[model samples]
Target chain A: MTSPVLTVENLAKRFPTGRSGVFVNAVNGVDLTIAPGETLGMVGESGSGKSTIGRAVLRLTEPTEGKIIFDGRDITKIPEGQMRPLRRDMQMVFQDPWSALNPRMRIGDLIAEPMKLHLGLSKSERENKTVDLANRVHLRPEFLRRHSSDLSGGQLQRVCIARAIATNPKLIVLDEPTSSLDLSVRAEILDLLNEIREQTHAAMLFISHDLGTVKLISDRIVVLYLGSVVESARTDELFSNPAHPYSQSLLSAHLPADPAAKLERHVLKGEIPSPINLPSGCTFRTRCPVAKDFCEHEVPKPHHIGSAEHQANCLRIPDGGNRIAQTETA
Target chain B: MSLLEVENLRTHFISRDIDNQIRVAKALNDVSFRLEAGKVLGFVGETGAGKSLTAQSICGLLRPPARIVGGSVLFDGQDLIEMPQEELNALRGDQIAMVVQNPRTSLDPLTRIGDQLVRIHQAHTGGPVTASRGRALDMMQAVGIPDPANRSNAWPHELSGGMAQRVLIAMALMNNPKLLIADEPTTGLDVTVQAQILDLMKGLTERFGMAMIIITHDLGIVAHYSDEIAVMFAGTIVESGPVREVFAKPDHPYTRSLIASTPEKLQIGGGAKLGGQPPDLYNLPSGCPLRTRCTFAEDVCATPPTRKQIGGGHYSVCHFSGALPEGGGPQ
Candidate 1:
């Protein structure tokens, strides 16, 4: 394939808290890379720091440590004034459509604003391209005449996609873009994203909490626990045989749509420890059933599960003791 | 007899638009269903399909600008709609309880969890303060709240999200109600926590022998936990049947589209026609609400269709129920 469009190495980010020395430590040493047209899926629960990684990759939020190299250049600490030109090649779409969109602006202008600023097109030229962009996202041109208030959640998301691609960016970070929408509308949006991915060949970092939806679009999947990467593998590999115990519990917890699907559930017992006071060694040790005394004293790094693409972080991986028994049948 | 029966339930929103024109949004039209004692019925639909409105209407929770223009809600041989406000008020908190989406907002922040539970019980069936407090502790333990003796004193703000939801369920069960309606009870919850809460709800319903109506947009929840399923569209129950029958052989066009949209069943780029935007409430089309997006629409669709019963108590409102191809018609 072509050279990777984005490479993030050992990225770490910490947000300051009210107290003097303590920090949220949202993202801790995340490593990821996306090929020119590949999609990387990041799945984690609240405070797992998946969203922070997305923002850090785009440099929307300044990072505390690690390197971010995009398209052959290191952009970990690029100055905001000089980063303006680079904005044309990177874009992001957030979860809530109502807040992401400008309610005061007309739909046509909202879609055209990005192109108008980035491409510097004339009035008629931008109008022609706006209509074309709307058509590309399967939005009818008539709806463009209305404001954001008149559109439904699905329609508003389409407008956001149209704006994101109007610049023809090399990378796009989508953070739970479809989580707020209904099921049918989510399918339609996923279809639209697949179509655009083929046409533009933009590398995408898809971050969401729903594993089922993430499996639909991502080529590779990364499992996170308490702001740290626990497992990374190919889409099918990760779903079929996840190595980490946290990943195992998450997959078994999902309820399949078919009523006849048998459930082997492993409901974790205690609550996730607050992010402010993460566990000392392996952050997941407190809740992990298979954890032993050694797990609390030593941190585990990435160990190969099968190949270069499949890896997980666990002390038990070396001893082949990471498997946790499915506890109950529902 | 069905524990709860809602027949021809019609609710409309009549309000003056900014232009001062009288407009009526037909929010709920001809919604009817039945629930057996100790059985769970799951409601699945899009955002504006009136799933929650049906629950609110049955409990007499409608406010101004929204009125129950037609129909009756029969619970335990009494019509909830025709009853007086005083009688309904007594029946509501005593016999029927509702748990809404946001657990934090639904709970009172200033009150301790134990006091709130005891107060609800005392309001319905008056007893000595110590007796009510004992009952509160029993319910907290039953709902899987760990260390019920100590956690009872924690206020709403002190409890975690999942813990708060458990307290809400315990409150609903305090009065030994005949029916419980939980609207999107676990929507904002984490997946692992969601499993724990759903399991607790199912266990409690069976133990108490009380009927339940679970209103949610997630089909997975309905498929796994519910005994029956009702698929709603455009403020109407387009299909209702045993969960197995409906999922295996969905008859209505709208139901077929919805089931196919689930991530487990859906094949991306399969070209399955998933076209549906909930109809314009103010001016819904005259005939079939789904005809606009239905690929099999014909001249006959201009006229309304009645409910057609397939085998095993499965019902569908379509002219050609069970006539579509496997992947749906004419995508």
Candidate 2:
């Protein structure tokens, strides 16, 4: 097996709320490893710390605990000066392309900026590669001289993708890259990302709240609740037989676009509790349909479900009570 | 008679540019649909497709610069378009309630949630204060807000996204409205919370026999929650029909592309007929608004296409509606 490109062990991030000693626990004890050319999708709702994990892995946001090893390098505590060269091997694509790009910069300059900084290339060489990158992302060469403000949302995102791939980084973290895009445009973006992944062989940490989109691109999947990962498995296995109660409920809640598909809905009651004051033990216990008394005190450890690669953090998995009964409504 | 019938609706944004030239955006053109009591109709489209504009026009919610140039919105046998402002104001919140997107911004920041609910009821029904308060609490309970008595005192800022959405739904239900128009109600909400809210709204509609028009960009929401679906493109409803029939056999090219773009059906690099620019509202094409982006555009597309009925009340506004080639699915 090829060596993993990125490995995160017990990653956690907390932000001070200005009230001394009060902090927002954004990510808590997340462990993941993404092999080269693999796409690991992270799914969660708002405040689930999916975005924080993506940012922390790139060292964009400092993790309060744990370690991030990229390409066998322990640069978690590396200073900015030392991290500059390493930045060439890590890239990130944000959610909103309109805000992610500089409006004043020409699209050609923006895509070429990464190459100019990382690669020792002349201006003409960089310009040629910029045009080549534009063609790869399916952007018309004429759009190169235009500003971001002149382009549509879909076009702006294509520019962002071109910039992210300019460096040919070893790892790329995408945070809901297609959430703001329209449906047809979203499919186009996903297709482009898949093609880039195959060509560049870059390990990707794909973060999104949309399960269907995640299922389309990811080879492996991780489900997060509050800040911790509740389950992680192979894509097909996770969708077919999710062991964690939260994963099951989440899959059940997703409304497929097809009207003919049977809907086995487990409409969970109540809202996700405030992340500031997380629930004791299992963070999802407050809303878990099959939560027990022990779930309030004991933090369930990850138990392998079908294989060593398929694991879930739920106490009920051992007793065969993890599955929530879904009502066949429609 | 249907609870609401909108016929040949047309809304335009007439404004002057810096050069002082009159520029009119044909935002909603010939929009028409009907809803019976206890039924749900979904308006699905991409941005700038005017799904929300149709709702705003039917409810008489258009502001300055945006006027209903031509249309007749009939609610319970009365024309809402011809109705006086004062009369429309009285009927709006009482019989025709609206829930917009952004639950936090829609609510009053300074007022407690319960008081806001009470105020809406009083404004519509002019009931006694005590009676209004009782109705507010009942509404909160109906929307499944936990501990209505305690949570009612909580301010809007204190509520979560899902909670705030529930409060908004409760406010819409305070007067037992006959028609509810929800515009992108669950756009920013979590999937689990979205299911809960959709179930709550669907249950409320059935219980009160209220007709609902749910406008959203998510086709999944329309497929399951709405009985009928209207596929809008460039301010016009390109297709309208029963949800099952439309999904089974979409006649419009744009509708086919949308359905094929879904993750379940999409084939990456398989020539899945996706990607197009939204029509320019200010300078729309002469006939088919989607001609500029349509893959199968022809010279004949320059002329306006007439609506063609494709059995079981399913209709498509395209010249080649029934004769279009098969294979919208990913190759």
Mind giving the per-residue lDDT tens digits that candidate 2 earns over A208-271? Answer: 9999999999999999998999999999999999999899989999989999999998888788
Chain B TM-scores, listed for every candidate in order, come to: 0.98, 0.97
List DockQ, one per candidate, in order: 0.79, 0.84
List the candidate 1 regions with Cα displacement exceeding 4 Å: none
The CA lDDT at A187 in model 2 is 89
Chain A of candidate 2 gets a TM-score of: 0.99
Candidate 2 whole-model C-alpha lDDT, 0 to 1:
0.92
Query: DockQ for the candidate 1 complex?
Result: 0.79
Candidate 1 chain A: worst 10 consecutive residues by lDDT?
A321-330
Q: What overall lDDT goes with each candidate model? A: 0.91, 0.92
